[model samples]
Target: MKSTSRQLALSLAAVTLLSAAPGAQAPASSRTRTHVQTLASDKFEGRLTGSSGEKLAADYLIAELKRMGAKPLPGQADFRMPFAFTAGSKDGGTTLKTMTANGMERTHEPGTAMALSFSDSAEVSGPVVFAGYGLVVPESQNFGYDSYAGLDVKDKVVVVLRYFPEDADQKTRAILARYADLRYKAQAARQRGARGMIVITGPRSPNAGELVPMSFDTAIAGSGVVAVSVKGGAWLIEGNGRSLDEVQKELDSGNPHVAGFAVPGVTATINAKVIRQQQTGHNVVAYLPASGSVSGVSKPWVAVGAHYDHLGRGTTGGSLAGKDEVNQIHHGADDNASGTATVLAIADALARQPRKRHLLIAFWSGEELGLLGSAAFVSTPPVALDQLSAYLNFDMVGRVSDNKLTVQATGTSAMWPKLLEQANVAAGFDLVLQEDPYQPTDVGSFNTASVACLTFFTGAHQEYHKPSDTADKINYEDLDRVGTFAAAIAKRLLDGDQVPQFTKVEQKTETGGRAGLRLFTGTIPDYASDVKGLLLGGVIGGGPAEQAGLAKGDVIVEIAGQSITNIYDYTYALELLKIGQPAKVVYLRGGQKQETTLTPAARK
Candidate 1:
């Protein structure tokens, strides 16, 4: 009797599988594992955007969508949508030469003296001046430390120490550390009319005498001033009868009285060359039409997307790899390949179901480079932005520990909670629903466009953004379950009689790891823009930017009397602003300069 009961259960399961839709009948785990393994394989080269590896991944995704009978979006010739971006930056060639008053001369090569990634490509010859740990603390802090006090650096090369004072007290160190960034120091030198700047790691600081590494920089333009870091520059200051060690010790005391001096008879010439590589990345977009269409009434669309790009060889930055794993391929299995696989699975399942709304499926690239692909899609969308009912994104959904799944951007629509609850009745997931839509993913792109959005994510893990995040570590069973759960949600969106309404949720301002930024302007920068000044993607509702009459497509040129050339400059200028204090903001809109007063609010 027991054997008969087991056989009966098995037969019922087989019948249930056979009765389901053709796409849904396939083994979910097998399909998900195959997709992840192939996409994260060694030959894919970690799918770095604009690289050969990314092209290969695109081809694979296109072929998979074709196999599922998905068609290109309306008005598109093919599934490939290309967008240009700065892939990375590198030193083309750098040369440094110095001549002393004693008729001694020396020339340094690129490796011995490295140009910073943000350095401008220029050749300048100027007399050298030593500026002690070049830092300009904001006046609001009242720390009263200025490295350029009473020093004239116009048309001269300013030599400054890297990092802040090593021996300062904890409170003082914290305050100084906020303004000690190398870019801020270079900005100070440029503001003082310095032609060039040289940096040296002081003897008291860690990694003394080591040249700064040329990390990857995404900015197409330079930092407006030529800058380089040297392994040693003791000879520049030795003419004053003081060794570099003695000067460093004095500066390490963090006293306010230490003054810098000119290096007598030392003239240096610097030539810096930084090459910003621009490449075109492809976003795979396909459409699954509704089962039936009514004449003269276009059906609203719903989108499901996931980014297919990741760090390559851990070289283009965003690598959390340790010393041992340096330069290794960041497989990015759980980081985003898992999300890509889930999207594919969801697409496959939805293709066979009858739908009232058109399903737009996309595989985005350049997400690791600040959601470039998704932003481009929204900026120049193939369809009307107002026609999009909702967007669902999947990222880092491979590892579902303790059956917990986090669904974010629930506040974007009032209907999300009920829809998600209905979908999870079968999934039985321990759901963690968050209301904020300002996430650091593709969902934010949709949110800014006034589209209702949802993103599914598993909790973060130790292997995130590292080479150790390989395909073998993925929880394939849970990944398949996530796909099923998301497919259910998408099904409801596609066939429901009413669409979800967009809701704007006011989020409390927080300094998202930006050092020393205490006030919130609620301005979202368009990172992909190569404009001379910071471009506004969109202003947060009810925030300072909106209240000041700033809107999307505005280019901020100056803030609080400081010039804003790029995002970095904007960040430095933002540090100078005080809470509840209104500052003059100069911006350009429609080729005309405009002025406004923005009163910054304290971060909560």
Candidate 2:
């Protein structure tokens, strides 16, 4: 009887697969080219922030929405919702003065001054106090010994290091990435009654100007901090206050000795100037409403989202294509245009049929700028968040390998596994379900809101974030397949009775997938891990070693007698061996002790 029930379930699922809407009969060539070419077109200007390219992309999305017979969101006549911002250069306005033992003074570039987003040009003068790194990380405990103990930066020029405390490693880099910023530090100092921020370079980097600006893509948006790059030599003034030699000597010796300017006794006369401006950018949004209501359900909304922003012409400098000016467009064909196109395609399909739930389709901006648009949408939703049943996000859905696709969902939602499994079994596609897809993408914001969400991705390729991420590089057939798969899932979500379950264990960070090995694997390795080495950012199940008695911090050092340098080595070595193979694998259990492994087998 049990076997009969299992067979019946399979048969029923198979029959349901046949009921899935067949892809509309459109000209294959036309559909293929239109989706790929339109997005990759140069008119979009690589869809950079506050640029004409992005506006062009917006116009196209609006038109596409209109063509699909989609209506404007409530409370608006048009689909566009405008927002404002300020962007510009700060220069020719700041000056610093140091009192010297003698009566000499030095002047520096006006551009080497900082300005806050909300700040108007102001001049300030104060005694300089050296704050080592100026970081207050509670996690690392690297704060200098009583560095800021009772010290007030209020109305004073606070000099701090560029990166962090004396050491440089992954933890320190991550710390700096999360906390270190001259603008925020200055603001904190200002709030504490400090006048100005003077960031001194460390011995590792004597020149302050050596700190180049990371592209806007890398930083979290809306963190109010103004930073200026200055050179060590430029901070020198023989008689004004301090000498270059004195500052360098103190920096090298790690002593807080330099108090007054060199040749102190002379009051330093300082003049500073700064300039600022506000800039405006726009986000593109489009939605298609569902056709009919469910038999019992009242309000239902299934949203599909994707961000159309790219790294924007590489770092502050131009890319290798001789487009060195930051103004050159960073055509992000695969990064998201692929996802955007898939969303558009899904909109087209749903427009042909109505479901119980209304569909909200959106093409977001500021995703690259830290999921700003999606975050804003969630906070001030066009529709109520509770009404939103599920969000299916398509990001990087255009590429596939060996006909394999990765579908990521925050496992906190119970509906995800069931829906994903049904869709995969129905479609008969080789689908890899990943529980933690919320990583640096728009879907992450929705997941954080406890909204049931799923991200369809083809995994990262070599061209990720590079200029090479052009339209010509997309795999359209695979994209079409992904789009079809997502559409099917969306249809099911609209019909299914399951409400999103907000599980308590929302994975805050990616834990790597289990490779069912005896060795430890801490970080979740990227899909491209094999080619460019594994980035310990993702894992499938608990890493092999962890399930086999390893911990989160353990690093795999050896597998099957082969040295493991990265995730690739571990995976490669795993492939060479077989299931149930008895092997000795070694790894660092934590940072202190090393441990050995035994046999490997299938996980579960």
Candidate 3:
């Protein structure tokens, strides 16, 4: 089963013999180019996930699959698989009110006194305890600090500054960042028996004269305490004749020996509310019945997949271009239209073969949005996951210039490299093999389930994710060769008795596949989110984000004062975050403005 001259000859003979079969119509280079052109053309509108283009493309694939005698999986359905995720936060309204010890009462408007996204929709009122930075760091490196230190905030609303000590040394700032989550801050308050927590940008912070803005992606599912930020809280504190500016200046002097206190004759009340918006998404799958099977043993199905989604007119899908700045149609011809086309070709070719096991050829939607379609399919597989023998994925297979073809997930199975070597003997190409199964493609979804998988790519170029990625740029002959190589491998896996072994990857990777980029924020960015801000699909539990209360769906707009208009900007900003220092991260949680201090760490 390994690479050998005899194996090579046999493999060539088998492919030739298979193609010569009465019903077999080997995938042709002309057909591959036609598929790519048909899928990438403007008539398809770039095949943006959840868009009309995607629907039309799906319809076309379904027709083609039907023509090839494709059927729905074990379960009955058309060629479409569907799933939903947090598209964004709903625009909601909130309110706040205040009553002083002197019987003076004031109620601030919603925009002027913003409600935090994570705040419970409840009310609280009492004497306010001023908590410095509202921070709590464990006994770490002798650098621990607690804003609730020696303070009696129980049953009272606690007023805390938004960040840690202003002038703390780099190490201290970094250490303090671990707990810079707003929800975590509220959690701490609730833990301390406080009814509520209020945040404000003290003189030492980066906010200006405006109400703190809430993010569009809300975080309304944590602790019982309600939280809000008041723009003019200085008047309530100044009632004690202690100027807020003086207190802030003193704290910012690099000596954060700052302390919290009770503001005499000052007390406040809080009220807040929220509304959620919901949306739906879809994925497409088609199945080809087995042609042949082992007589005495159960046979596993082979899954061939590729994402058919792309950034639509620079709207809401992952894009390298600035939001609305580069609004031309992004014709992702090479990104995966190439991969999708190959899947189409393979379906027709596989239909004519003997069914050893089932073949599931899928063209995924919302892949640009974070492999969502693939992830969804994996979550609720049409067939038993254990019955899946192997997954072969093709992405960006259109640009195989110089015969250099990149194959990822070689580590997934010991048989892969040798088999690939054997397959390439007849179709010569420079193969670059990567052992790690982690990649930004649909294959990652199968790999997550411990399924042996492989993803083929030509390589990235300047045109990737750009409007310039048109059908004309695709190297059709190269793409056709890739499809041929992949189809052969798929056929060998399905027809032979040997099953590829699955290897679980254990290499530690930083948040959002940033190990090579070198920085860990513990945030899993939603690659499919087309929002102007960086949308987080997930935050690693117990990581810095969870420690700081950063939750899923939170869209980060700025990091360390740098505007993050896109993922590329976020990447550039990561380089500026000094290790052992806390930097402000401004974000939106369902129309509520919120910020947090995050400490950067070297990627492990």
lDDT of the candidates, in the order given: 0.86, 0.58, 0.73
Maximum-lDDT candidate = 1
* Full ranking by TM-score: 1, 3, 2
TM-score of 3: 0.73
Per-residue lDDT tens digits for candidate 1, residues 14-119, read 5346435553455767668767876777777788988899998899888778877899999999999999998667777788899899878988898878788778
Which clashing pairs does model 1 show? none
| Best candidate (score: TM-score) | 1
TM-score of candidate 1 on Cα atoms, chains taken together: 0.86
Q: Flag the better candidate by TM-score, 1 or 2.
A: 1
Lowest-lDDT window of 10 residues in candidate 2?
A: 526-535
By lDDT, rank the candidates, best first: 1, 3, 2
Off by over 4 Å in 1: 1-25, 43-45, 96-113, 125-127, 166-174, 201-210, 219-221, 235-246, 264-269, 291-295, 321-329, 401-403, 425-430, 466-478, 511-516
TM-score of each: 0.86, 0.65, 0.73
Pitting candidate 2 against candidate 3, the one with the higher lDDT is: 3
Positional deviation of 560 in candidate 2, in angstroms? 47
lDDT of 1: 0.86
